[model samples]
Target: MAGAQTYESTRARVEQYFDRTATRTWERLTSDAPVSGIRATVRAGRDRMRDLMLAQLPQDLTGARILDAGCGTGALAVALAARGADVVAIDISPALIDIARRRQPEGLPGRIEFRAGDMLTPELGHFDHAMAMDSMIYYGAADIAGCLGRLAPRLAESFVFTLAPRTPLLMAMWRVGQVFPRADRSPTMVPHSVKGIARAMRRAEVQGNLRQIERVNSGFYISSALEFRP
Candidate 1:
């Protein structure tokens, strides 16, 4: 039941956080760490989510128009362009958009356009597919539904996004973490359960399916990807 102001405030905070840590996030997304430890495990989990999303995309993206909603540092945008999909990448953080534009690969068959703005309100053209990796974690269920309601109409095929899983154990851990003082806690990291995701998707009038991806300690489900179609 968060109001528009609440959602906007949350997004503003997230934008600021990402603006400050854009470079750090870029490194994490493209790092080459040792392949057998905590860092490796974490990287593998992230890669799995990205790979799962990429797998859902059409193999032949020639002349396709793809929307990279909430495209953090343009990693996925660049990947889509490499596959011959014209990509329009949007993010709330100007710094992240700047980095994305700077890091854009040269001589790709498809073009990439980076924009700094809210995904829900951007006046972009229609697209064949949309992907919002790891970015919708900032919004509440209601806000997510609102975003989908706005975005679904502009897509010709489907939309894919990731959300932090809201299991009981994970919620308890989150509460415990909030009880303590932490400098690195993101104010916008709102996790949603699978049921919550479904409800939001339903509210947005989209058919949604989820696949659990990252599980930690074999107990807490860390995240999942949701694919939606009209």
Candidate 2:
């Protein structure tokens, strides 16, 4: 377990991170064409990530309420909304949300909402599905457990989240970061080991299946998509 800052403070820092990283992430996500062979290779990789997530979604999205937790550029939120889900995309960064709002279709058939809020807060309404993408790495065992506990009941159907592998080196870095989260010339993510994540999820009483997806590129990521019924 680790001590984390209050939701208000964490949300502020998360917003700052998005303000710094959104431009590049947006350009990467929205590019019409890849500039190099590596870029082209990565495109398929990114799409595969999205596809794997969507495959886990229910067949009919109409009237399906969804929460996109830490939705970076709102790509997933827009896609789900387009598919007829009532989408509420929440992010700590209003700047990124602004970009996402601008990028969203003005006359889409379905409604999509954008919210700037903290993930640990209960103010955000309930949903049939809730997703926290790569942002799941930001919390430690305690905070992660607490956040998931908060989300469990709010998620009427399921919750899905992505996590980076927690190698020993990564965990060491996270422990070091407790002293200085925004340290030095670079900011680092706090990755969780698969075992640690599973333990925490179980403690939170959330059940899910875990799978490893190898993208077109050599890079691999882990996804844990939990299905819950209340």
Candidate 3:
């Protein structure tokens, strides 16, 4: 797992990117407004990814407690709540959280508690199952495992999350992103291999093995989901 300094630095950059730089773009992308073809593909990909995560959980979550970690704009949170799962929807960007709150419907079958903060926070309490979606795609493998280590103790059954898969094209894009001026750059999406993640998790007491993996590829968006279970 990443040392505190390295993990924190990456986290700060992510906060800046989501909270300021890409806030408007994200807001628009998550909306129904027409977007460019590339963004449309990204939207479709995200939808597929969300459905993929939901498929891993119980269909009737009547009494289940779930943490929609990095619940950007709250789509996943809303869906979970609609299925009767009490959901804690968290994100680092307060602006996004505001948007998510505004988008939430009245009288959902299950309640949603929206908070803007790190998803790995202990104070958020424990859950039956947790999902981080595309949230950890920007961190290094070890840092991702550090996040998993922290959240693992809070989970009773499973934690499903996504990582940018290591691929030739993604590696090339990562290289290109490193050349941009820091102020002008978005947080880099660090691609990772499953084997690399397993190795990193070995350093932490995650106490789980990856039980499932799925990939979604839609034009500009590509992500891989892994379910970690104790």
Candidate 4:
């Protein structure tokens, strides 16, 4: 709740960009559909990152309730459910949520539930663990920390999320994106240093030991994940 207004503003931009403009692009990218070489690298990077996060968790997730924050087209949700995890996959984009619900396989009625809304909504109930893949990239460390501060109370075990690294290339790209804003383009991602994020987390009074995980880089895609546990 520290940067409520800023977080909400970024959240709205993300929702609008994904829901109104990038639905088909995401659907195709998340699928086996052919894409350009650069996009192929992005797809590969995301796959590896997803697997990396999954590997950090227990193999048998039976009875474990997980929040798949910003689950795009249901890949992570489906994978988590396959491991017997009860997953609540939420995205801000209703269009993407529709695709996710449709892509969700049958016979796993309660295995995964798809919803379109804020991931911090208390109505989604508590979770043992949560994973927010590429969801907080558009927000700064302060806003990211604030969002986590709100979500920490409902999470009993731990949560993991990815952020754009504060590399020179990424910073340049961010600046360019801001200067030449396009209505159809995805919102510009704000890069953050690990130390900056940690400081923000401490200032927010979010009780947790923050750990830096691996960074994934493939062509145009570059991201690092951070894990927090009480």
Candidate 5:
């Protein structure tokens, strides 16, 4: 379980990063305020990506059991529940989990079970669908395969998640980002190429399609969504 331990360490670091900037991150995600700067625009783009991912879900979620893997701040969980899908949301960050629980909406057609834990290991029950948004960026190729391998069996339908693109242009940009590091950046964030992700999915015995998401002011495509059937 060396890989698991590595992932745990990665999660711990990510937790620390989010905990320190939870307030600002939450505002960036939930607010529509007119903010200036490239960071603000990137945040808005991420929000739009979330909307696009949600739209990819099944039109009818009534009575569906959904796994909101790495459910940061519970935005997607709330949206899913609002659409009548019972959601089991898990995250490694305690502060973000607390924020999600505290800010949970009042009424919804479906219920949400918020838990603070690693997505790599959760005592999850059967789910109709599972989604991991931008959370998978913290994992490398092998870890991604490991996660998908475990999660595939628990899912009856499909799995949807995002991954950082490994294109040459983006790789170069990622390298450039290293020179001017931001306080909010997570050290564990590793970009995977499209081929690498597809290989991981294959190793996990999942078949899926991928589409490159448009990058805003960023040099490369932000991330691509992988929609797979187990």
Candidate 6:
């Protein structure tokens, strides 16, 4: 992994790329009439992440208004709704949101609302809880605090965000890549180290608990559960 890219320009470029690719990816993930094999990959990834998030959340999801930020394919949103939370799942890509809306399970008692929009924006209202799974990787360092800060007021009392940890080894590799700017300007995929994440939370005036858990092979995702003042 290269060093983390936190430049504003780089962040904008990454978002643009995602908007372009989201359509194809969404279509491939939601092909359910015949159940395409690619759908399995989407299902597996969503299942792994949803299960982990649900296990970590302490609140009863029943009837709670939960916001699923960067809700790709809406797996977490759908799952949360099925478990009783009233969900508002938002994503930047319309293609992905369409797929997620189409995949809404039949006769689900819990309500789910899908929106196509950016998480950094203020339109998304505060809710009982919010979760950004694997979505913070797109932000530049300058935007991390702003992104989370905007959501703080919307949180009724708590929120959760998952991020890829920026490690020392990864930072070194990223620095080496910076020397060869033309080779592959792609910044490191790692977002923030554990310490850096803590700082970000403090900067955002968010408080509660932070934990790092290894989800797959050797990689870890940091989960920050925030308790906000009413």
Q: State in Å the error of residue 20, model 3.
A: 1.2
Error of 5 at 14 (Å): 1.1
Assess every candidate by TM-score: 0.83, 0.75, 0.96, 0.96, 0.83, 0.72
| lDDT per residue (tens digit) for residues 117-209 in model 6 | 766556666588788776676454435555655666677765566654465655675567556554224334554655675576676565545
- Write model 2 residue lDDT over 78-155, tens digit each, in one string: 778877888888877777777788788876656888877776567777888887766665556656665666777677
Cα deviation at 229, candidate 4, in Å, is 1.0
Candidate 2 error regions (>4 Å): 1-11, 21-25, 28-30, 33-44, 167-186, 201-230
lDDT of each: 0.75, 0.64, 0.89, 0.90, 0.75, 0.62
Top-lDDT structure, candidate number: 4
Q: RMSD in angstroms, all models?
A: 3.4, 4.2, 1.3, 1.3, 3.2, 5.5
- C-alpha lDDT of candidate 2 relative to the true structure: 0.64
Candidate 5 stretches with Cα past 4 Å from truth are: 21-23, 176-185, 201-221
**Residue 53 displacement in candidate 1 (angstroms):** 0.0
Between candidates 2 and 3, name the one with more favorable TM-score: 3
1-230: candidate 3 lDDT, tens digit per residue: 45667788887988888898898999999999999999999999999999999999989999999999889899999999999999999999998999999999998999999999988788989999999898888888778778878877788999999999999999999998887657767888999988888888887656677744789999999999999876
**What's the residue-level lDDT of 83 in candidate 5?**
92
Any residue pairs clashing in model 1, and if so which?
none
lDDT of 4 by residue, 1-230 (tens): 78889989889999998988888899999999999999999999999999988888898899999999999999999989988999999999999999998898877634998999999898999999999999889998888888788888898998998999899999899999989987777888999988898899888887777888899999988999889886
lDDT by residue for model 1 over 32-109, one digit each (tens)? 533445556556676677778888898779999999988877888988998999999999988788778878879988
Spell out the clash pairs found in candidate 6. 3-174, 126-154, 166-192
lDDT of 3: 0.89
Tens digit of lDDT per residue, candidate 5, span 1-230? 32677777777777787777665656555556665676675666677777777877876799999999989889899999999999999987777888889889888989999998877564677899998888888777877777777776788887788877666766786677767888666553577876776676666565445444443233222667776666
Q: Which 10-residue window of candidate 3 scores lowest in summed lDDT? A: 204-213
